[model samples]
Target: MKAMSPELASWLRGRTDDSVTVKRLHGDVSGRLFWRVFTGNGTHVLMDSGKIPVWPWIDIHELLRANGFRVPAIREIDTRRGWVLQEDLGSRRLLDVDDGQYMKLLDEASDIIVAMQRRLDGRTCADSIAGRRSFTPAFFMAELENTLETLFFRLLGVPMNELLELQREMRTLCESIDPSSVFVHRDFHSSNLMVVDGRLVMVDWQDARFGPPAYDIVSLVRDSYRDPGHVWEDRARKFTLAKGNMNMFQIARTACQRSLKATGTFSFHYRKTGDTRYLGYIPRTLRYLADYARICPQLDGLVRKTYRTLDKYHGEIDLRDFRSANIPEVRSR
Candidate 1:
């Protein structure tokens, strides 16, 4: 079967009659398919969000655009089917840049966070989807529950009793972060940020919501995909501007939660699809947990136990999926 559907091809040609063709681009966890549509004159980025609601993407795009952010301009859209043809911002993601350039450009990205934190205040975002909900402690723990299931319990076979202590300690970590919410991109990692014409263009923002001020910085500096090299304390401090003056402790606290969350997501997706690429992130994120444990002594036991369990089951995990074959409805209330 052809990768391009007849209807989609017709839709593209219908819009750009003089177009050459469309080329597929690597997609991410989000169910959105991105395409670079080539035409006689230039190219346009086509965002196919599949059967999901496209309004959030459109709504958030306009919100960011009005806030003086560099999001793609929507040229055409089919809101019912979740299709958007927008400006092509080129393909030089910050993820693909060298360390020196990545370091320099990341400062600009960090400044973007500061600007949003300052400009996109609660009142400005009060009517938008981002304003509707904030990342509460319950939400943070719910994400960690997924990690406990996939990584600790299901995959590595850690005992339930052992995880209880970890869970209790992590609860403190969750409750420790600043409760005040700010408009955040939710996933402000390198891959979602495009470096075009000596500037940064943010994308993959459909999941934007009001989260802890440290959430976006944690996602960027301690990015699961790419390491910021050395430590992230200094970089994280630059963006930790909140009402409570949330400091390094909050940054490390947020990192522990976010890294574990990412690790769980990778494990869930890997087991469901048998994809080996997810395996690579598992160890890296675990390492981040170790690093953060030093900053927050509460995570020390959880970190050490995680390492021990992972090491004990390293061979089994490498050999096969083992006990993680079944996706259980594990919940911790």
Candidate 2:
């Protein structure tokens, strides 16, 4: 592990007593660094975001907190330094729980998402957030292209001609969705959610944008970390339908789109960083894509071809051993 920068050390010293200790915490794929800062009084997480800006996270945190959502409380921020001190929400991810508790947590998460949408629906987002890209036909189509380039071509060895036809079908399917202007948590999966004080707390708010309400719901229920099984999936659908007023088709369509993006994202992460943990998620994400494709007849044949390609090379790869040789093991404090 490398030492903290002089400016960051100075900043931390100014924020706490001289006896305070700062230790690095395990970070996600976003490349941001997190530190567990222990002072004489208590503990807090210091986010050193490197070149990434902090305004979006700060703005979204305020918006969600004002609406009674359980986002981490902001203790301090230095937008210029790309650092923030936030309330420590602990380490219990929704993915770390048992099946029974997982379902209950999903129900709670569904309620929170619905509440957020109800409060912010049709309301213009902050200028910074509003400026971010909306989920349009082009964006959906690009996600399909990303899947074809990274997952099919690079990983599964599918031919260009097949990928092009599949891309066309996916684009057509995406074009059918009516555009929505509701507030959306672009990455609302299990890993970004923490269970704190027996409540669900959402993190990683910087990527939020305006889009369809069903997108976030689909993200939660069809998360790549763990399979919620058919029973929980149905329960989640019912909860979202009653709270978010989204029909099954809308949810399924969003799930298909999101799952396609997930496959590309997982593959890209593996290829770029050599992180095999992400590769383990590809199969589950594909299963989600396959399941949702059944409900979307427009892309059925393309999906069938995708499965055939995956089956062709099913047993040849050892995805679990692809961890990057250059990356160091960093333990969470």
Residue 267 Cα positional deviation in candidate 1, in Å, after optimal superposition: 0.6
Question: Which pairs of residues have clashing backbones in candidate 2?
Answer: none
Q: Please give the lDDT score at residue 265 for candidate 2.
A: 90
Could you give the C-alpha RMSD of every candidate to the true structure, in order shown? 5.1, 5.2
Going through the candidates in order, what is the number of backbone clashes in each?
Answer: 0, 0
- Model 2, backbone clash pairs (residues 3+ apart or across chains), number: 0
Predict model 2's lDDT versus the native: 0.75
Clash pairs detected, candidate 1: none
Relative to the true structure, candidate 2 reaches a TM of 0.89
Task: Compose the digit string of candidate 2's lDDT tens values, residues 1-333.
Answer: 556798888888898877889888888678889989999889999998887777778877777777777788888889888899889988899988778788888888888777767776545355446335478888888887888788777765677787777777778778866577577888888889998877788999788887877888888888878778785458556865676455666777778888878988987887787666776776666766666666667667766766666655322232222222212222221
TM-score of each: 0.90, 0.89
